[model samples]
Structures are given as C-alpha cells and as structure tokens.
Target: MPRLEEITPDNVSAAVDIKVGPEQEAFVAPVVTSLAEAYASRRTAWPRLVYDDDRAVAFVMGNFDPDNETEAFRCGIWRLNVDRAEQGKGYGRFAVLAFCEEARRRGHRRVTVLWEQGEGGPEAFYLRLGFRPTGEVLFGETVGELLL
Candidate 1:
C-alpha cells in the first residue's frame, strides 16, 4: 500500500518530476508550484505527498472551510496528481480516500472537486469515485461535490 505524507518544500522537486508524459508534465509543474505557494500562505490548507516506499508517487492539495451561507463545514479537493508510471495501480483512489478521511476528522461534512471539460483528465475519474456534478461551471471547469 502507498502511504500519504505531508508535503514539504524539500520534496516538491520529486513531486514535480513524478508527473507522467509531456502534456501532463507541462500542466503539472506550474500548478504544483502554485499550489505549494498557496499552501504555504494558507497554513490551514492540507497538502500531501503519496509515496511508495521512498519514491514519491503522487500529490494532493486542498482545504477545509465552513460555508457561511449554508453553515456547513466542507472540504475542497483542489489538486490531485498521480505519477504516470504509478497510474492504474489504485494509488490515486487510496490517496483521495485518505485525504477525505483526514478532512472528515477535521470536521468537514462534505468534499468537493472541480474538473475541466475536454481531453484526457480527471472528470471521469472523479465521477467514478462518486462525486456528483453541481451543474455549475466555473472558469470552464465542472464543479463536483460528495457528502462525506
């Protein structure tokens, strides 16, 4: 089984390198760096690295917050990436589950994720994991939410 650990600046390089293929590599690098900076600025955000033994295989970054209007605490699954070489081994699912559990422990009542339409990407994967579309789109991405 893969283990999830908190991401630190020291391991960000390895995390960036784990992205699979040229297309993914281009998209992942800048986003990971931005997420890292966001996490650093927002200390309450959760950022994690998934590792198989000593090799870093994936990453997830998000945060928990209480919706003022709804008065419900919710978790956001902002960014998730599993190394190309490590894809299809169930590692991504396990990592997300672990993150959800952590969010629950932190008092979140639900978790949400957003995915853009088109191309090879996470929309189908998030759907497979039981996340329902909100029927709302933002910045060209579909928003999805799942009750914990």
Candidate 2:
C-alpha cells in the first residue's frame, strides 16, 4: 500500500529525485522548485512525498491559505509530480485524495488545481478524479475545483 510521508531531512534527497516524463515536463515544475516554493511559503504549503514501501514515487504540494487574495490559492493542490516510472499505479490519485481529505480536515469545502493545456498535461487526470473546470483561467492555466 502507498502512504504519504512528510518531507524530512532523511528523505529530502529522495523527494527531490522524483521526476515525471519528458512529455509531462512542461506541465509540472520540478520537485526541487516546489520545495523552494514550500520554503518561501512555509506557513501555507503542505508538501509530501508519496511512498510505496520504502521508495518515494511522487511529490505533492497543497496550498492552504484560506485568506489568500486569489480564490484558487485558498485551498488547493499547487503541484503534483508522479515519477516517470510510477505514473499509473494509482499513486497520483492517492496523493490527490489525501490532499482532499486534508482539506476537509482543515474545514475546507473544496479543493482546487491548476493545469496547463498540452498533449500530455494533467487535465484529463484531474477531470477523471471529479474536478471540473471552475471556468476561470489564470496565467493561461485552467482552474479546476473538486468539491469536498
């Protein structure tokens, strides 16, 4: 079974090593960048590693700033990267559902996600998980929301 692990000194290297395929490169930022962003926004960013046994297979960052100026930033997934080899084993879904459950625990009623449109972007994956476009586009990325 897969489980979420908080980023720590011991597993930081493994988290940074997670990478997606070349086709998905343009859609998601690197885990290192997300880590840096998490540092800058430490109060609001909830970043974690998806581990299957002892192997870190993905990185997911959730933003939980209920008072953020932007609606999409209120309570949502800011970045998700499933390692190239670990794409289809349901790790991505597990991470997202985990985030949604976290959001609910935080008293949030919805979870948002942003996705760029491209050949191998994550729009379809988000949709498949019951996230529908919120009909708002920010910086050319479609805003998606899943009600919790």
Candidate 3:
C-alpha cells in the first residue's frame, strides 16, 4: 500500500531521490528543486513523499496561499514528480488525489494546476483526473482546476 509521508530528516533524502523519466522531465521540476522552493515558501508550501512501504515512489508539492495576488497560485499543485521506475503504477494519481484532499481540508473550494502541452507533458493525465482547463495560461502553461 502506498502512503503519503511528510518530509523529515529521516526521509528527506529519500524524497530527493525521486525522479521522472527523461521525456517527462521537461514537464515538471525535480524533487530537490521543489524542496528548495518549499523551503523558500515554507509558509505556503506543502511537500510530501509517496512511499510504498519503505520505498519512496513519488514527490508532490502544493502551494496554499489564499491571499496571493494570482488566483491560480492561491491553491494549486505546484510540483509532482513520480519516479521513472514508478510511472503508470498509480503513484502520480495517488499523489494528486492526496493533494486535492489536502486542499479541501485547507478550506479551499478548488485547486488548480498548470500544465504545459506537449507530446510527453502531463496535460492528458491531469485532464483525465478531472481537472478542466479554465482557459487561462500562466507563463505559457495552461491553467487547470478541479472543484473540490
């Protein structure tokens, strides 16, 4: 069974080791980079690792800042990286569902995600998860939202 774990000294290194395939790399940032961003935005960043027993399988980060000037950034999936070896094993969807639950718990009515469109991008996967494009684009990434 896979479970989401809060990043800690004991598991921080394991989280950092998570990686996506080379083709998917252009779609998202790595766990280490996401961790750095989380540190910089500790007040709003929520980073977690998905572990199947003792094995780390994926990393997910959400940014929750209700007062942010940008509506999309107020609550959204900031980064998600599933290990190259763990792709298609449901870890990515699990991480995303976990993030959505967290958003609802945080009093958010919806959570948004920005995905770049390309042959190997996550646009299709996110859409399949029920995130509808809001017709907004930020920094060249299509803005998508899922009502909670």
Identify the leading candidate in terms of lDDT: 2
Q: Please say which candidate is ahead in lDDT: 1 or 3.
A: 3
Residue 144 Cα positional deviation in candidate 1, in Å, after optimal superposition: 0.6
**Candidate 2 local lDDT, 12-78, one digit each (tens):** 9999999899878999999999999999989999999999999999999999999999999999999
A best-first ranking of the candidates according to their TM-score comes to: 2, 3, 1
Give the Cα-based TM-score of candidate 1 against the true structure: 0.83
lDDT (Cα) of model 3: 0.93
Stretches > 4 Å off in candidate 1: 25-31, 67-74
* Stretches of candidate 3 exceeding 4 Å from the true structure: none
List TM-scores for all candidates, in order. 0.83, 0.99, 0.97
Better of 2 and 3 by TM-score: 2
RMSD, candidate 3, Å: 0.8
| TM-score between candidate 2 and the true structure | 0.99
* Clashing residue pairs, backbone N/CA/C < 3 A, model 1: none
Give the alpha carbon lDDT tens digit for every residue of 2-62 in model 1: 8987656788788667676566553344446756666575854677789989989888777
Q: Which portions of model 2 show Cα errors greater than 4 Å?
A: none
- In candidate 2, the residue pairs with backbone N, CA or C atoms under 3 Å apart (3 or more residues apart, or in different chains) clash, namely none
Give the alpha-carbon lDDT of every model: 0.73, 0.95, 0.93
